[model samples]
Target chain A: MAINTEKNSYTVIFAVVMVVVVGLLLSGISQVLKPNIDANKRAEKQKNILYAMGVNENQGANDVVFVSDDILQEKFDTYITEQFYLQGGEKVDDPEAYLIDIKKEKKKAEDPSYDQKLPLFKGTKDGKDLYVMPVRGKGLWDAIWGFVAVDETMTIQGVFFDHKGETPGLGAEIKQRYFMDDFEGESFLDDGQFEGIAVAKGNNDPKNEDKSDNEVDALAGATITGDGLATMLRKDVQKYVPFFKSLQN
Target chain B: MGLLSRKDANLILDPLADNNPITIQVLGICSALAITAKLVPSVVMAVSVIFVLGVGNVIISLMRNIIPSKIRIIVQLIVVATLVIIVDQVLKAFSYELSKELSVFIGLIITNCIIMGRFEAFALGNGPWKSFLDGIGNALGYGLILVVVGFFRELFGSGTLFGIEIFGNPVEKSGLYAYGYENNGFMVLPPMALIVVGIIIWVQRSRNKDLIEEN
Candidate 1:
């Protein structure tokens, strides 16, 4: 109490000390959690990769044999045998797939002669080869991304989408399985042409669409997000078409 | 009287009823509306608020004398913000899914008003231990309303508590639900939360005449 409680000197010192203490404490906690957070994120991507490849939590390999959370890492390592990158209709071995930050690489897309190596994951399940690519786009509020899986013939097996800050109960439906299931069995191939899955603004049945094979029902009241999803899928998937076609022979 | 004085006990009890932060004082309603759509998130928010407010109150009270009145709010905010960040980190580490569900609300706890109100009104003038008690009182009061509203909302809206089906899977049990036992989808909306809290205020005020205004 000897220090005057009303002095500018006191306030400045207090502010500095408090900031240093809080900053150090938060940094320390974040440092301790860095490993686990990274692991969780990697595991989540692995899970999505498996999910996109058509592996279910409890319906893969025999009548049961579930791929629970603890086993997702192991399953991913086993199923996804190889990974590589492609740059402008050519296969390459320069960059790894999992490490590519789609959010950043997405920026290079604005450049016409974009030469960034795009990642492609290769896996096999039940004798069927799977090719997967990560896609990113802007949602209503923030970034939206997904893992898209397709077979050698350029048909979508399944997809796993998640968003950073889409409006809950409305635009956030993209993350739900019910909404994602709509993408199941849809193909990027339409009559021997590359056409990515389109998220329609209408919830009309897939059979009712003019291009039923390439369209899925959109979330009601979330047209922007649906359109964004379509744009994200189209632009990102095109990067992997060369690699996928290269493996067909 | 010892530390377990009637007055100190009243600090804990009174807010649970008469001076309730959510229903009575009408503070910290944003979280109540946002997180109450599910019972689990409401409980988590309640526990988090309790920890942050209680610890922040004690920190502020201990520093009350030295805290320049000019920068006390800043100081209080620092304490609350640090505690909230720690809670958020722990949730992310351990309760990852729950953390995802709570999302921005956990960070938003720094602005819950109830915590700041107690720091200014009680912690500034009281002993650290007393302020700690007052903080718990307010947290419990706020949490009580959140839990009640969450319980009702989740029960009727989702036909579940903490995601457990209580009405025997309302969607699939249609043959058994011949009498039309359907989940009230409207109860999940934000306005329904306001109505639930209003009903609580009505019931509490009806039982306690002191809550009624003279006007």
Candidate 2:
């Protein structure tokens, strides 16, 4: 029997109907899964922070243990306190709208206030108040973002890095716990001045007479990525300087 | 609608062996080259692809009759995008960290040629059952290459497989896998994936010379 797979009215109508049905079905399923996805993201962020703090004992980056979503949420509620924009040395009055997503605003260059609404995460570790501030900037070929936890005096407690397009083994080493460990106990402020962090290159002996806590060696082979990171950190860290200073009083 | 059956399982299995997309057809090599660096992610990607391709094929075939020729491509796209979004959302909900690791690649599946090609070429004229089988067969074809590439990249790149240390590291006080050959860090680089893919294609062509011929 010769089947007429022609583009007749019935065929076109059927196709449109089928497409709509499938679209609706998939959307419904996606709606059902949305909550799970959000939970996962929160848990992963916690896992990364723990790894950066050297709390995870696994040798490979893969072995960082993740607690269940319920447990993670419970811990997060009790521990992590999400802070929004702190302008003029005071936390924003209405932080709801100020919880800006920098990712969504990158394309538009019109708003100067866009840069001020900083999203900060604060929690406790080892009986000390650890304030984790978010930072974002360019890497050699892509964007790099991370969380830096600083103690009461603005000294670095831990750092967690995630990048979009940095070269592996070179710039991508930022994701390694050892690289982040280098930041522990380092100072974001030196001599009462906010000097921020530095990305130097090579065997930068922190013991070398000239090296200071504000500077750490960059990955050897990724010069562009390293330079990009240094520039990005310089710019992003400055945005939170006021917020950090306000906490002192 | 009834023309496609397991009786013609060759229609499905043949692609995996000879008309392999990643190796022979080279239809969807982008993901293979990028995500193969890690075993867990590569495996997740492979499963995601299989899911999308299989579903897209069956849906497109079922709706082939009603879709307007002038707007068929757009209709196919809607179907593909919907499936990709569902998979992405499902991953996010159930395995958030793994989903993050998979990242934009899951969304990128919407553009993967294997799904589009199967829908347009094979599924548009077939029955839902036949299209589903064809989808699995073609996905297997693409997935075989992904697994091979992912295995090599993860094994050598990270000095481990699925995060487990296969070769001991004397430097890290683990063991001895030849003092300095602990981990071939180069395997993790994207360029290494390209080279590995190139080798797979080379081997595939050598075994089946007919694949080299332009159809």
Q: What is the TM-score of chain A alone in each candidate?
A: 0.87, 0.75
Interface RMSD of 2: 4.1
- Per candidate, the number of residue pairs that clash is 0, 10
Residue A127, candidate 1: Cα error in Å is 2.8
Candidate 2 lDDT by residue in tens digits, A25-105: 977887787677655555676655544444444654443354455565566555555545554455763323213555564
For residues A189-248, write the lDDT of model 1, one tens digit per residue. Answer: 787678887787554574433434588888888988888989999988876776667767
lDDT for model 1, on a 0 to 1 scale?
A: 0.83
TM-score, chain B, predicted structure 1: 0.96
List fnat, each candidate. Answer: 0.58, 0.61
| Candidate-wise lDDT, in order | 0.83, 0.73
| Candidate 1, superposed: residue stretches over 4 Å from native | A58-67, A88-96, A108-114, A202-213, B1-3, B174-179
Best by lDDT: 1
By summed lDDT, the worst window of 10 consecutive residues in model 1 chain A runs over A58-67
